[model samples]
Target: MNPFVDIILRSCTVYFFMVLALRVFGKRELSQLNSADIVLILLISNSVQNAMVGSNTSLEGGILAALALFVINYLFKRWINQSKTVKDWVLSKPQVLIHNGNVEFKTLAKLGITSEELDEAIREHGVESHKNVKLAMFEIDGNISIISGDNNLKQTHHKRKIHKTLNEL
Candidate 1:
């Protein structure tokens, strides 16, 4: 195989593999990055560099691999946008955490969210308590969104800095 073609194929393979890994691992990871997350990401990038470029360490080889990644990513995004099935499979749907001042304990447990975290999110949104929240949702992007049941109907979003992995919880 031509060196350039080989690089492209390798890059494409790495791209798909990374995507699959992220999807399988957890989409919540995309929303926030802690120290461990950042370190792991850096290490993964370093580890995959050789796999994508192979023996060709030339500037051209590196550029070609990056180009292939960009093209593949663009095409994948377009496909995801066009196909509902693919979109549903690749993306997470928003989860309702609270409704009508009622906390969804099952949802919190499933998502590995603790009551303290929920309370913090609620307080950040300026709601006195969960009972004052009309609706709370764990959005697809991993942020907690709150809507207050007050007459003013305040709404707010809180970006979580830490997330407990499902295995840990």
Candidate 2:
């Protein structure tokens, strides 16, 4: 196979594998990156770097691989944007973690989110308690979204987790 063709094939393979891996791993990971998560991601990228570009250390080869990855990603996201069914298939549906001031224990458990984590998120928003929150959703992106009693939304400015150290614990 041509080296350029090989680069294309390898990059595409890595990109698709990562998408499938993320889906199987669940949305909790994509929403917040704990220290362990960060380490895992960094390692995965390092491991895949050579796999995507192969032994072609040339600038052209690197640029081709990068271009192929970006193009594939853009096209996939565009396709998802065009079709809700595709979007649903590719991404997790938002889940309700709390409703009417009641914590959805089952949901929290199913999502691998601890009650302590949920409680901390609620308090972080100044809602006082779960009872004061009209609704809380574990969004498809991995952040817990809160709607309080006064029709105000207390949401994290950044989706990335900053202070939490025991996310998986």
User: Best-fitting candidate, measured by lDDT?
Assistant: 1
Q: List ranges where model 1 is wrong by over 4 Å.
A: 163-169
Which sections of candidate 2 miss by over 4 Å? 28-31, 151-169
Q: Local error of candidate 2 at 52, Å?
A: 1.7
Best by TM-score: 1
Score residue 13 of candidate 1 by CA lDDT.
Answer: 98
**Per-residue accuracy of model 1 over 20-135 as CA lDDT, tens digit each:** 99889866555567677889899999999999999999999999999999999999999999999999999988899999999999999988888988998999888899998888
lDDT of 2 by residue, 50-159 (tens): 99998999999999999999999999999999999989888888889889999989988897877777887887777788998888898777777778887555455225
True-vs-predicted CA distance for residue 63, candidate 2, Å: 1.3
Model 1 residue 28 lDDT score: 56
Candidate 2 is scored at a TM of 0.85
TM-score of every candidate relative to the true structure? 0.90, 0.85
